[model samples]
Target chain A: MKIAVLGSGNGGCAVAADFALKGHDVYLFDFEEFNENINAIMKNGGIFVDGDFVGFAEIKYAGHDIEKVITGADLIMVVRPAFGTKLFAEAAKGYIQKGQKIVICPGSCGGSLIFKKGLGLELEDESIIVSETSTLPYACRVIAAGKVHIYIKLLGGIYLAAIPSRLTENVLIDLKEVYPGIVPAKNVLQTTLQNGNPVIHPAVTLLNAALVEREKGDFYFYEEGVTPSVGRLMEAVDKERIEIGKKLEIEIIPNPVLGLIQGYMQESNYDTGYSKGRGFKGIKAQSKLDNRYMNEDVGYGLVFMSELGKQIEVETPIMDSIINIASVIMGKEYREMKSRTPETLGLSSYTVDELINVL
Target chain B: MKIAVLGSGNGGCAVAADFALKGHDVYLFDFEEFNENINAIMKNGGIFVDGDFVGFAEIKYAGHDIEKVITGADLIMVVRPAFGTKLFAEAAKGYIQKGQKIVICPGSCGGSLIFKKGLGLELEDESIIVSETSTLPYACRVIAAGKVHIYIKLLGGIYLAAIPSRLTENVLIDLKEVYPGIVPAKNVLQTTLQNGNPVIHPAVTLLNAALVEREKGDFYFYEEGVTPSVGRLMEAVDKERIEIGKKLEIEIIPNPVLGLIQGYMQESNYDTGYSKGRGFKGIKAQSKLDNRYMNEDVGYGLVFMSELGKQIEVETPIMDSIINIASVIMGKEYREMKSRTPETLGLSSYTVDELINVL
Candidate 1:
């Protein structure tokens, strides 16, 4: 199958290389501002894959032209941070063809909804299918410009759902070719709530804001940062998220349980599960508070959950609290920013039943 | 002058010794559960003073008997943590005589009001003058039972106020003898708003919750635990506190400016003012999340400010956020606990003007 990957960062490079290595035609593209990795990949002719999937896979195309990348693609994957979703979607709007599929790998809370709106399409438009995954399929990184490292390929426990409930299976069938563990979710809400980065990242980062700035995040984030108090905070956020899911009639798995299933943890408890988790053994925290942990997770992810809770009448005091503190730490009012709130997703007046029916 | 110092902890011992050294008859009292320090003082017949003030000071009495401690005392200084204000007030209720002045050394947000309520006295009842100070005059600690170390006796910038406002001068006159830097406040609200612990303690502690747990608070709290982001959080809380004070027609000095005026900081910026503050130089953080930094500061201080903001129609989102997160970290609902709030202090129904009139 011909595939178009619309980001050349860590996840984008890994996704592009993984499919290219599987003998599929892969075209990688990024914004011109991020041409460092694109230029390197063009010169090298492909991305270097290491660890779980080791090889140098050749790409059909790598450049700044979105038209060349997505015109004849069988599948399009938008792999960018949550904040970049709208930018990428807007960039691809004029070129998006009918019946084409675009999946945001690891939709950080309602990424599909945001992407659909950014593409100037109604959420219920059936001419094109837009979907999102619960999480990225690989714990990977771009070691250098065109060199990528795949720590793990995420053997199981990834959920995918289209914007419209009826079309989730169609997207899952296409995604399963690359991710055998990809499962169809009830709707995009399930995929959004099931993504636990919002539940864990902001809580851990806000609680460790000073430590990260002081030590320049020299300490292992999961091992030393996930103390009992920090775990309790994550639990508080996770409880609010699960409550929001219950209000929406979506059964969301707790973060620790999901961590265990995803092979990220050996235990199913918040504290020791992450602290002693085999997968998170050596991940260091970001050296500053302005990183994606608080900005993307709190601004986009938690703000989305908190607004959804407000619409559905499920109290999310903990999520709101984390958003408030994170906003202060980042010197921005995240709640007021409306980066990915219900209103921003064009669901401000959405009734619980209406939301359930639509999504 | 005859002085009774309630709570034989650090502040209590320091106050008792300071007055005794000035030739006033000092009597120290505490609950029997904390008879260790009381018993030590009883055995030694005095408290050993060190640091800024170095000398042996005689105490008129030291025991757990409240009647003996309060009877015939011209002035009573309640120097316990904010949580103990009510307990100590209830203990001194039966022995509190007319015309005697009782002052909570640092009214951790409406301490005088809680103390008066705990004494079963109507706020307007002026039989005994109930007063409070903006903060403790000395940054001192009890090195051991019957031994106290005075790090620095503050030379200026302490505000004192009485319940009726008119009688503030009377308490100020007596307190000024020991706390020469003390000045009169507009009301108890001024004293409450001027206290900076709620602005600094919980913000810094919550931001460093995991580090405190992992390191057992081995680092210098102010110098190391405080960073740019932590200072920003503190500044946010301080802004909310000042807004609450403004709604009540009380002019509150910003925390960093107050810290400079009180000699706790050489610089007047929140970030480095705390990180490099000469007065805060070697103070260590609490070894656990369950310490008074959160309990006394958040439960009593931030909660009171938040509740006051609610009653006065002033927004305190940051204060409320810190209270919510601290409640989760401590596993207690601080807002619902009513440990200290406008309702608990009998100011819940007051309008802004009425609240200003009362305080």
Candidate 2:
């Protein structure tokens, strides 16, 4: 399969490397400034995949030229966070070949909707098929200029939904070739609500605002920072998220259960049949300040969850509190700074049924 | 008027010294450890008042004897914070005579309710009248031992409402004779909601959590801490407060108007008002590790407000957020540590009408 990987961040580098190692023709395209990174990749001549991208022999290409990357590509994966998803998607719309499937690994909840809205693309824009998974497949980061170090390969069947439902099957086929573990969610809303970042990250981060800001970010955020009380708050927020999901009829695996799948929760804590680690075999974690977890997850993902609650007549005090607190931390109101809200997403006045229909 | 000012903390010393100057037989009582503070009375034998307690005299009656202070007292003003209001009320209950009145200076929205419950008394505990004002009249604290410095005296009618309707007139007469400024609120609920501490303190403290924790007992609390965003949260909380009051058919004052009364907002920038030292008159800044703003106001006050919102079905996201944030900072689950939640206060499952009846 011919694949074009967009964005040269952690997710992009990791995804491009993985696909290339899997004997797929992978052309990873980013900007000129990242040419140092791309040139290093070319010098290395192949990706070093510790888990998913283990073998370096089976490879294709890496570059700053989108024209070369997207030309006759069978699939295009938008691996950037929610902030850059729409821009890359619209850019792809201008250049990509007709019938190229666009897969967003770790769609961060609202990416699919973003593409459809940002580009003014119709649901029946048959040439482009947009699908999203709940999260990227690995707890990985770039080890050096060109080398991506894959850490925990996350597990769990990712949610896959295509625009207009008509092209879903084709997109699913393309993603299945890459990720055989892909689990099909009913629709994009299910995929969006399945987001763990908004439900957990912002609640903990905003609540622990003082701790983080006190000594200038020296804490092991998850291992130590996510204490019992913080976990309870996450549960409170998770309650709201699950409630909204239930209201929308989105099947929500419990947090601990999902965590077991995502490798955050210890499955040994419970007798559930779920395994210990979420095998994120294909992606990396972006540890930058402007990273998705803090910015997009808090801003976009939380906005969607909170707004969905508003639409469904569910009171998400925990979610709203976290959103507001995050906004204050970021020095912007979630309603205004958040790229997607019920208001920004044109769903502020939407009824539950209307929201479901629109999504 | 013979006045027994309970609790020889800042308020206690100030009240004792102020009443003594007014020629009332004022007896100040506290634990024996506060004898060091008696030096303020020893140095000058009374408070050196600049504004309200202007004239200093050595009329010495400050002691740790509760029984001696209560002897022959006409009015015993219970000036303790809400957390200890119950214990003080119960303690005062055993010491009072038939015609004596127990006035909780800022009935703090529901002080009478709490007082009546704590003493195992009924709504018609007519013998001992319990009334409250919106707040303490003086913006004064015992900065040094026994030295109760006065700031701006709040220029509003202090609210008052007796527990039993029968004792309302008698209580008013007693309180007015001493205070000469008691504006009778409609009920205990009215007086309780009149509390501006919950509306102001927690919002500022929690929003400034990062700064407070980072600065670590070095920053100006009320005078320099309340930012515009903090003020917005205050307004949001106040809106919920007013909504709760409306649902319960009680009048709660607006926050901005209250701020205007506090002399913080007078069409001036924060830096200007704060730098020029014109913000928050009567309210001295807290530079202690333990802030009453975070501990009492956020813990006791916001939990009370949150509980009230639950009773009235009004959503107070900001209030709950600040409370939870404060709890995180203090390492306590505020909702649990809070003795004033709707559930704890016996209003947990009350209907609107039922809550109204209780109020």
lDDT of each: 0.88, 0.66
- The ten-residue window of minimal lDDT in model 1 chain A covers A278-287
lDDT comparing candidate 1 with the true structure: 0.88
lDDT of 2 at A300: 86
lDDT of 2 by residue, B116-149 (tens): 6776777656666666666787667666765667
TM-score of 2: 0.67
lDDT of 1 by residue, A229-268 (tens): 8899999999999999998899999999988788888899
State the local distance difference test value for candidate 2.
0.66
RMSD of each: 2.3, 7.7
Give me the TM-scores for chain A across all models, comma-separated.
Answer: 0.97, 0.87
For model 2, give the interface RMSD: 5.6
**lDDT of candidate 1 over B1-359, digit per residue (tens):** 98999989998999999999999999989999999888988998999999878999999899988999999999999998888888898888888989899999888878898888888889889999999999988888787878988877777789999998999998888877778888999998899889988898998998899989998988878999899988999999888888887887889999888878788888999899998887787788887878989988898888888878877788988898898889888899988888887788887888888987877
**Top candidate (DockQ):** 1
